[model samples]
Target: MKLSKPLIIGIAGGSGSGKTSVTNSIYEVFKEHSVVVIEQDFYYKDQSHLDFEERLLTNYDHPLAFDNKLLISHLRKLLVRQSVEKPIYDYTLHTRSEKSVLIEPKDVIILEGILVLEDEALRNLMDIKLFVDTDADLRIIRRILRDINERGRSIESVVEQYLSVVRPMHNQFIEPTKRYADIIIPEGGHNEVAIDLMVTKIKTILENGTELYYDDDINQ
Candidate 1:
């Protein structure tokens, strides 16, 4: 049997809204199939070329922070089952790393991140676009804790960043993109029913012989 081109699924939310958790949850659900995830974090521009202060001034939450052109190009190729090398970004150092990720077309392709919904071109490529809707306060608290433990940041710094950078960016870029979602899950990973519903839809699409974006009566 000929394998189909990967189905592109996009998940977007504010920081600590459980984007990765949702991706992983769905990934586990569809473990029997070949799945590849394209992380939005990997597309950060090369920060090494900028000074520390300039890099700090860079709006990481801004849609422009991502290499959207490259992402769109890669996703277009991926729709036709082409392989590509995605960048590797190092959060600890806040720089694009030298290494690259070799991504192959699979049964499923998921792209997850805070600003994934912001780019119109990228959004158009998604077979399913999901928004994880967690409240601002909860997202802030989770981000603070996660950054402290995972990224080795102090509580004070985390709070400062959240207030100065995170919140404003969310308002300006991320939150508004919720309207673009084909589906929205509240409280993210806590919504088991929604996750399962999404998984079932994906499975049904595949089982019905729909090749991701193949033109069919229902899908059309």
Candidate 2:
């Protein structure tokens, strides 16, 4: 049987807003099928030409920091039933790896990133858009812990970057894009009610064999 068009979901939020958790929950439910997950961070433009110090100074939270055009092309390919080799970015090294992840065309596509909803072309491609709203205090704390424990960063560096770049970028670019979200999720993946609703909606789209961009603000 021919499968219906893939459902493209965009999950956007500030760093450490639990976007990953929300995405993981959805992925777990649909793991039996062909589901490809992509991260905007993986499409960060190569900074191999720049010194490590220069790369560190790059405004990662800014939309220009990502190779969005490439990402959009990849997503378009997946939508048309074509496989793509997604890039792999190394956070610790501040560079993209030579290797790429081979992702087959999927029945569902989940694009997760802090600035995923900021791009116009990318936004147009999404079947559903979600924004994870979390308090700045909570987000900063989570970012600190994640960077220190997972990304091997020092507490001072993390705090400095948060104050200098992350906070400002989120205020200017990320927060403004919240209006574009079809659903605004508070507390991220911890909100089971919201997650369940979203999952059910996706399942409904699959079962109905059609995509509903909006149904009189049904989910809002």
Number of the top candidate by lDDT? 2
Question: Number of the top candidate by TM-score?
Answer: 2
Q: What is the lDDT of residue 140 in candidate 1?
A: 86
User: Model 1: residues >4 Å from true position, as ranges?
Assistant: 1-5, 214-220
Task: List the global CA lDDT of all models.
Answer: 0.84, 0.89
What does candidate 2's lDDT look like per residue over 1-220, in tens digits? 3334688999999998989999999999988975778999999999989899899888888889999988988987887678899999999989898899899998789999999999998998899999999999999999999999999899999999999999999999999999999999999979999999998998888887655332222212
Report the poorest 10 consecutive residues by lDDT, candidate 2. 211-220
lDDT of 1: 0.84
Clashes of 1: 0
TM-score of each predicted structure versus truth = 0.91, 0.93
